[model samples]
Target: WDEEPFELIVSNPPYSVKWVGDGDATLINDPRFAPAGVLAPKSKADMAFIMHSLSWLAANGTAAIVCFPGIMYRGGAEQKIRKYLVDNNYVDAVIQLSGGLFFGTSIATCIMVLKKGKSDNKVMFIDASKECIKVTNNNKLTPENIDRIVDVFAKREEVAHFSHLADYAEIAENDFNLSVSTYVEPEDTREKIDIKKLNAEIAEIVAREQVLRSEIDKIIAEIEG
Candidate 1:
């Protein structure tokens, strides 16, 4: 408990595992949880790990933790902790990756980047949900995909439909929701159809069907006559 703080902290902790949370009354007073003004819920320990990482982080450290999607938008204690991080400029960036990237589950996960020393009040959000390719039965991030994500993270650029830099006011307006989708919009990949062209095609199909029906009627009349 008396070692030097970590300059970089990275972890993919057990997602949403149960923890003591506020059950251990003393945890509220812990330096890690105290600044957040509340403890993570006992049933969801995701934020607990975040707080611990933040505490152990050196003044210039950056912590990147893999998190479940729920932790990004869950209300109550988690929201309060998000507010604390955002207000204090500890949050650096949030990246959402495609589902099925991990084994045994197809649930999408997000990476939350936190820093003890930040140069700005804006938080960068990256929507890399479509950055992976389907490999066998699972999705995998190829070297190219990884490079794309890393490039955006490194430049902190605002790429349309890919990344966004949101200020504190924007986060506050959204009620402190840290979900990447809130900032970086997903690119609409659905095919664009011209309704007029589609309707014309349908009209042509119906006209051809009527002509065929008329021909059949004439053929039947000739046989009857």
Candidate 2:
């Protein structure tokens, strides 16, 4: 197939695959991967498809791709590819989806939105990991959930625990790790503990135990006498 840029691209590329193996290293020189300056590991072709799609992305086009979570944070060549994408300001946003949203597996997937002609150098991250309803054996994303995500994405606003807009400098400070959790904080759900009250209760219990022990000793002594 020829590398021709398109106005739009959408794909749910295979999460991971061993593309080059057994000392076959021909892909390292592929023009599509030239911008990344490195080839994705043989065991993981996630970046391969990303770079391929990006190579053919039109200047005014956008590509929405479903990706394995690992590609956002894994080290080595994948990290380098992410650096290229981030440094060049090609990545528009990364949306984290709820786990179990897909059939046959419960792995949480993420969507990476790429644009060749971006107006800004920031990347928006949406933590939609909880935006789903459990239906029987898997989770389902309702229209409301999708709308909420799209709203934040379109606005590019920062919502507490739900979304964040991180600039290139911030991403660089983070070593180009595009994991949503790294940028958008999750809501804390665990019950908050009052340490002072708990300590007072423990002290009261100890005092009551001592008093009961003393009373029991006196009763035993009286019985013996």
Candidate 3:
């Protein structure tokens, strides 16, 4: 803000309905609003809230905004705004939380970290969806779980199917889809199977069938004779 000199800005913004979108013209012209375009369909007010946070961000300060996953990859106004920010390299990190984290809704959410005047030309993404365990019926991020995520982001490590550092060019190639899942895939839960075990079972069954056929052949021959 013009009156304050803050370093870091972080908050949990509202992600709800009745948000201004393509129906408004002022949003399309605002320079601080990133893409100079419109937001996607019925995403509630996620992008609008993000834009507000981005504008208040200091030259060297950082702001973390919580939003629904739609803003990352949706087309139209939302994509345009995101492209503008990413193209200029304002995005720092996008952390996706697991489903069931929020009650009354099963939708997974993501946190967008933005930094002004960043020297690094890369964006960090963390797939933290599986990091938290469920509490009662709602999933929550434990202190250690939060620490783990923060550590990963700070270290910028290349984790397998977890975190990734992507440049603006790569994001552009992906049409500005910043969905955490797009960059960091959730760990595949499909159980690893043993091919040898399957083959052995199949072979045993075939051998038993062969013995049964032999017995049937002998019985038919004896009866005919």
Q: Which stretches of candidate 2 lie over 4 Å from their true place?
A: 1-4, 21-26
Which 10-residue window in model 2 sums to the lowest lDDT? 20-29
What number of clashing residue pairs does each candidate have, in the order they appear? 0, 0, 6
Q: What is candidate 3's TM-score against the reference?
A: 0.87
Candidate 1 C-alpha lDDT tens digits along 1-225: 566699999999999999998889999999988999899999999999999999999999999999998988989999999999998999999999999999998999999999988988999999999999999999999999999999999898999999999999999999999999899877789999999999999999999999999999999999999
lDDT of 3 by residue, 96-129 (tens): 8888887688888888999987878899999998
Model 1 score (lDDT): 0.93
**Candidate order (TM-score):** 2, 3, 1
Among residues 3 or more apart in sequence or in different chains, the pairs in candidate 3 whose N, CA or C atoms overlap within 3 Å are: 35-80, 35-81, 38-77, 39-77, 39-78, 98-129
> In model 3, what lDDT does residue 109 have?
88
- Per-candidate TM equals 0.86, 0.91, 0.87
Q: What is the C-alpha lDDT of each candidate?
A: 0.93, 0.91, 0.81
Of 2 and 3, the candidate ahead on lDDT is 2
Model 2 over residues 38-115: C-alpha lDDT tens digits?
888889989989999998899998999999999999989899999999988899999999889877778999999999
Q: lDDT (0-100) at residue 141 of candidate 3?
A: 87
